[model samples]
Target chain A: MEKKDGCVKPSKGVIQTEETKSAAEPVQNGKETQKMLAKVGKPAPDFELSAFFEGGFKNVRLSDHKGKWIVVCFYPGDFTFV
Target chain B: MGVEVVAISTDSRFSHKIWQEEELSKMVDGGVPFPLLSDAGGRVGTVYGVYDEDAGVDIRGRFIIDPDFNIRAMEVLTPEVGRNVSELIRQVKAFQHVVETGEVTPSGWQPGKPTLTPGPDLAGKVWKEWKPEMAFD
Candidate 1:
């Protein structure tokens, strides 16, 4: 992917169909077997994953927060000294 | 400040619960004030290009996504170094400023600082309007 005019070009034509198919499943069990579609300067790849929030477990989808800025942080593991 | 934050890892929800209660809660009053997501088998991480298949974990990385769902900036680093929260906040503010106004921020630009208008006339004349020392001030 290349950055142009402050936006990254998205990889074309392969993400939509796969995303739609995955969306059909009510819950994703971390078994997503599709190609990576995320590119910097392009729409973030849609995802639905289980999350522990507010003392409870709930499913969180990336698309749910449309129209709001989001910060997605990835860490190696929990309880690590980092 | 109208931003939503989430942290993802290969750990299960159960593990997140323990860590939140035993560790994160001590760092902050009520622990991290955002969702602790479980990516389980690195499914989500793989899509973001941060998953380590061999290590079975996601590396340390962060992405700032705009309200339009477009990724504006991303940072990835090795485990030895911790990410800086101040820099993240600064970048977020810069992005918001650019979105609100069509001006681009200079390096280390903060709120209330002068911004540059993007155009051909402003290209070479940048040195006249903005100085190298301004970035440090």
Candidate 2:
């Protein structure tokens, strides 16, 4: 969503977990999948990820970004590798 | 033509805040253009196929989704390589142009350049109508 200053801000959340080992899998139609998707022609799996925005936390859903192009980037560590 | 950029990492929101404050202070406005997502559980990272389980970190995975939520473009890369923002911007512009005008942008297409109208007649004659000299930088 665009902020009052006209700059589009990102939404994020924070929830630490003990588990770290998992495989990447493809998501089913509209369902969350842990695997990598096969191709880029299908609809993206719907998901809600918590985001950090404006010094606060909120839930950001993929479906909420409909009607506008969305760029989802997954990067490595924030402090170490980023 | 509105586009939103979201990034996910295996760091907590607290870490994101630190990066924004300490390291990313030189950003355009003192922070990233978009929000840095906190994929604390590694759920989003794993789903997008960028996480390295052995390192407890993610590789570089980028996806461009159209307005209808279609996966228009995606690139999964190793952490050693970084993404190119200029190329990504070009692609977003190209995709939006097609969605709006129903015309396909040829290779090396930038804004305000020539576009090709896909049709049966143009099937094997794209080079005839579009010459490389006609391209706009």
Each candidate's clash count: 1, 13
Model 2 chain A: lowest-lDDT 10 consecutive positions:
A13-22
Quality of candidate 1's docking, in CAPRI categories?
A: acceptable
Candidate 2 TM-score, true structure as reference:
0.78
CAPRI quality band, candidate 2: acceptable
Q: How high is the lDDT of residue A24 in model 1?
A: 37
What is the per-residue lDDT of model 1 for residues B27-107, given as tens digits with 9 covering 90 to 100? 999988999888877777877888888999989999999999999999988777899999999899999999999899998
The per-model lDDT (C-alpha) reads: 0.82, 0.73
Candidate with the greatest lDDT versus the true structure: 1
